[model samples]
Target: MRNLITFFILNLLCQSLTVNADELTVTLLGTGTPIPSIERFGSSTLIEHKGKYFLFDVGRGATIRLSQIGMYPSDIDNIFLTHLHSDHITGFDDFWITGGIWQRANTLNVYGPDGTKSFVEHTQGAFSLDAFYREKQSSLNLKGLEVNVTEIKEGLIYDEDGLKVSAFRVDHGAVEHAYGYRIDSDRHSVLISGDTTYSENLIANSQELDLLIHEVSVIEPKLLQSNPKLKSISKYHTSLQQLHKLVEKVKPQKTVLNHLLLIGSDETELSHLLETKFQDKNIDVGHDLMTIHLR
Candidate 1:
């Protein structure tokens, strides 16, 4: 199926934004959380501005999801990670290794939190033997196998050609250095809420945005009572109730909910409830490969 439901999902939510080629294009390459699902892939997003592509959080199945949207792994030259969670970075090996095989154009550019440089080095070390034989191939581009890593903290990390990428810290349980990203290109902007739970810093950075892609988890109250571990995990992400108020306060021109954790609850009814209550807010649930064009 063609899962890039930009205009379709927008219309269903009682709002719409046109596809403008000369503007920023955001594709929800994978929208699943840590849990595996056939419907959703994982937490990955692809953004293109001024003929350059950037990826955020290449979780499991990211490379396969990218292929579904007319993009190969080689297209992902730059990647920004939220945290070093296993689920958030599991697909990196596939993206990095397979992308090199597909003939990438240049060195891998990776930006992440404190341990980013170490992570990149370790990934290379773990796959040295595989990368060695592949590098020996005469047909391959040697530069594609090289990597450039930047350890990011708060404030601006990337600024070039009217595109500015700013990282802001967010709360994700014990994950001390979790971050939410705000990307601004020309007059348009979008904020990607990486995994978080009631983050005031995220709210502060989310003041003005054309689109806000947020992670949400709706665990049934009874489930939390029955399973203590579930309760602990619930603290790691924002609930629909919290997001309801969040969308109202932040008030982005459009909001898409991804990385859903709907345990023992009806997502359709709840999503509809939120949609009806905030029709003017232009909010919708994100699925894998859903692309939103911003002008």
Candidate 2:
């Protein structure tokens, strides 16, 4: 009975954030791309450090994913966006409005590359009437409805209270300015590669990292056979074939692949293939609502 009680306590500690105050609490809220899937929501990651909740990207169903881990949209204040891609920022509108409704009294601070301000403005504009109705009809915090936007070009954008974030450029096909983030909090460092096709800049920024959350593009064999044109889409993201080189170069302490392309066969293929190839490396295929307590 004593052992059983200890087991339950350990399980709850692993699932939630009541323990490990000094470590970086990383959660993959959504690991899927624009392609819809019941398993993966979209491209959203939640980072908790120094008692502050920092969200990376607000893709589709982000709020739902957050709720799964006993968190709500209102708990997040700092959100760093990699780019303005539809798959990446589609859930921002929902996170913004719903957070305010749920009592997020502080302003939503958003950091991203150029055109991010315009995107936020347009998103708010599209939901103008709804915001107004809620403001009048409900007991929502007006300040929470407000958002603080920071459009960054490069270099260190955020530095305060032991948190530092650097934004770097990446190659994403036709997109002029897709970026990734290097987030560090004294004890732990994490790199998030938002939709990119193997950028050398990532290598420059990612060194001695505790956790590396990167994207991998792999369309299953059947999907490619059915629609050969879809192969071009892989050009925009780092393919499974090219990922080993990046992993070798960056050589992070740990790697979690995010923004996974759909189809169960491919997920299995990715696991089995990488398991054989990256046998010595600590790598994992991320799933939605997956939590990691970085030590």
Q: Model 1 compared with the native: what TM-score?
A: 0.89
Residue-by-residue lDDT tens digits, candidate 1, 88-119: 89999999988888888878889999888888
Worst 10 residues of 1 by lDDT: 13-22
Q: What are the clashing pairs of model 1?
A: none
TM-scores for all candidates: the values are: 0.89, 0.89
How well is each residue in 200-243 modelled by candidate 2, as lDDT tens digits? 98999998999999999777767766775676777788877678
- Overall lDDT per candidate, in order of appearance: 0.86, 0.86
At residue 67, candidate 1 shows an lDDT of 80
Look at candidate 2 and tell me the lDDT of residue 279: 94
